[model samples]
Target: MARELEEVKWEKFKLGDLFRIKSNLQLNKNSFVFSENGEYPYFTRTVFNNGILGNVHYLDEEHKLKGNCLAVGMIAMRFFYMDKDFYAGQFTKRAIPIGFSLNSRLANYFITVLNKKSKIFQSSLVRNFEKVFKNEEVKLPVKNDGSIDFEFMTSFISELEARQISELEAYLVTTGLSDYVLTSEEEKFLEIFRENEVKWKKFKIGDLFEVNSYKKRFDANKVNILEEGHPYVVRTALNNGIRGYLKEDEEFLNEGNTISFGQDTATMFYQEKSYFTGDKIKIIKSKYKEFNKLNSHFFVSAMSKSFSTFAWGSSSFSISIIENQEIYLPIKNNEINFEFMETLISAIQKEIIKDVVLYTDKKIKATKKVVSNK
Candidate 1:
């Protein structure tokens, strides 16, 4: 059943009236030791990755901004809902609710309002929050008797979250991850190979794939980065490493389906679209007509694990080493078991998709219940 939204009464209020503006402690960049595995998150003017520049273990509770507060970027009009107690970097400010307990979801609502209002004040290096935003009028949901509707705000966010989760689940489905899983019969059948009862022949990497020694054709001058153009740009990373796009180019490097590797990092990526490779990228495609995109992906996954074995950790990653390498694939009666490869990928994808879909479905249902009850 569709949840019907109650009539919301919006009341205008100045920014200062609702929340007490507070600036974060000025900690120098060097004072904080950055690490991916750090205890606490350190936030900066970084608009990307939700303002988390890096993680740190700064144990100053007095200086740290507690969870469920809004962090506003000083220079840029960037805002994020700091859900965890975070160490603030230089040039950052936060909002403390005047009298109410600010939930992170509710803080997200306020950040949305603040982001739209503050966009006009952006681009300037210096920012006077008191002058620009302190008295800025904004609307908030209110009840029948002229009180803030916290429940409605929570429900609104919850409904949106449900929809977003469904969208993500749909996306996961499109990735072919939700296609199929291994049945009991299929799993038992593969136990023979797992037990090493079936002998599989090893093949040299050079025999399967050959690197396309194409010169880099990406020129920033001729091919401008577009909002939506041919995905003529790809890097060595697995996903979303497309720096820019190109409309037209003389040497548009496009291999229908191939594996790309970073010459220095040994970082591998599978490319399906026609895209021009960035600097230090080595492209390799299947030498045999039997192999396709699915096979390339499985090979890339296998090769990614063996990156540490290569001598490229000290020096530049040699394509020659990868070319001369050997990989083992399941073989039946002197032929590659392409069906087994297909089933293997499908089973793996299904397992991942199953977990994600289960979690997301539960969240959506829970959020929907909250919405419906409200």
Candidate 2:
């Protein structure tokens, strides 16, 4: 009741024989800017994930008119034969296939097969590739009808795409539900909002915290994360609004007693945590009696929302910018308890973490079912 695995004869061929391989046009020192009304889509290493496109960057007319490039559905294999050549920085390799003459549907299927088989080839010339591409051999299956079964291959790929879309929709729905839950809790807490404006006083964050100005040391060969070393933070991570404890066992700074924030993308993402391996993070340590309650995780999350305004308020990176950034704090005798709010937030975080684990399991099961059927 299931289709048997076809035992078609396979032919081996060189990659250079099938298509022309070339590096993308270097954009010099100019930064890429995305335009909504731009003429053409810009492709990059980030475009490919599990053999699919993510986001397309748009370029103005000048760049678009230079050369006609491959469109969606073509395979792009990163070139490794030359010593001076390097794949796109974001993702090292890609495979772009010829689209017109070849069956696009079968070509898609063939690309998937190539990806699976790429791990088997090896070369001494290349340093990073698990399988060497230049001297490697691949097998091509020919159908009995002479022409490849483009229709069947297309149907299979279409089915895969449909299933993937369904899974993505489900994931979105789950994310929405989690957001709703957190928002509802925040709303409930806000309901008890007391004006008690007299009890609230403004103070500079730097006045309450000790700032440590230090740089990270880097080593190219050392990649392992240190267990009890300083954590490195960067601006890019701050812009993305990601917050968490670092797991890497490497230290760039000698001391391990502060939290870092990104200053450049502060306006876009306020107090987001950024990752760094070297001298990019600004560490701040709390110096008050409430240090236990106002730890790095709690303080970082609070700042992630307004990092831009804080960064702009300062002129130099050396001085403790926290002193200039104002925040409202509850008085010791205030009727509304600050400890209660912290406890509620902690409980909500626990629930969200649990939900994430459950959702991940469901997605894994759904993917396994689809792959098994295929």
Candidate 3:
């Protein structure tokens, strides 16, 4: 993909030069009757869901933006490439390809460029996002004669899609390892050595780990700044609980790899760097001896699954409730089978690595072929 972009000549052009833009028609929110069984998607000025507020029964087929059109949110200033014919309601803008033809793949790629540009125009000074995007200039790949390279764009996107699919497949395989799924041959191999009764040991979380609560306060505004810095984040559902990064300063608190959790959100995260945390974030570390044997990544994965058992229907998790939580472990002889835990995680990592390597090789070859053809 990088080679293709490098080979092609690029030309800078204003967004209005490539697209015939249209601001959304004045349609009241009351007219959109959101329903579960609706046919058309009602689009609004929101960042998520391709700006889709909800599915509505309203039918304005002639006025609705066609599939493969780019929709820019006026309020959030984010770009979304519509995949289906949808209703474009109030406070939105649609950009239809003009002169040059664009497939779904190329339009999707353009969305990235537009979104990056939108990020730069932040501040109340640039209140009208639609107006700002209209005049923004973008550099696009062009052929030798300086025409848009649609073929290269399509192939480049396909290459990226293939790689992403492979990574997701690898993730799925690794995550599935926690639940033992034995093949027929493996099942038979273990049958001969399988013991009828296995020893189990139970211990409260506090017994094996140090639950330290830091009293250092982080200013919510400074810590939550969405910029590249040392990770000073609170926990959330996305990106393994990374809300955002923050800068390192005297006020910076917490360090080392440990299991972190959002007490309010009841989500688990593995923090590997020195960072600060929000009010409800709790950090748990294994005892000096236990840390050597226990794998933090494996512990995090297990704890995430166990969250439901403890949290139940509650949205928040109390520190008292978590410290007293007891966990079961397999015992060999009289001691905890730390080797078993290590081996299990190692096996999963090996399998996932194999899948990732194989897929990466295939993606490289495919990308080379596309570049060579050009």
Best by lDDT: 1
Tens-digit lDDT track for model 1 on 66-162? Answer: 8678887777777888888888888888888888887767877888888987666574434566556666888888888888888777767766877
Tell me the deviation in Å of residue 55 in model 2: 17
The global C-alpha lDDT for each of the candidates, from Candidate 1 onward, is 0.72, 0.44, 0.67
Runs of candidate 3 with Cα error greater than 4 angstroms are 1-3, 61-63, 120-134, 177-374
* Count of clashes, each model: 0, 24, 0
Worst 10 residues of 1 by lDDT: 232-241
Cα lDDT tens digits for candidate 3, 1-374: 65555477889988777887777664566765789888767777777766788886756756665767888766566778877777876767778888876676787889888878765655434355546655879998887888877777787787787677556656656755333444454344244325534466876777767677644646676544656876665666777666667665645567557767778666777776767777677888776455542356666665665666664446566667777777766568867766555555555555456665566567667655755665
Model 2: per-residue Cα lDDT over 1-374, one tens digit each: 12223654445655544444433443321465445553433444332443222222543333331222222112333221111112122223333444424343455565665555433532232243323544456555445755444445555665665577567657656754334244554545444443333344556777766655545534324544444333333444542323222445334333433455434443212222224433334556566544443233445555654354444535445445545676655444643345545544554554566676566558657656655665
TM-score of structure candidate 2: 0.40
Of 2 and 3, the candidate ahead on lDDT is: 3
Please give the TM-score that candidate 3 achieves against the real structure.
0.56
TM-score of each: 0.61, 0.40, 0.56
Number of clashing pairs, model 2?
24
Prediction 2 global C-alpha lDDT: 0.44
Residue 166, model 3, lDDT: 57
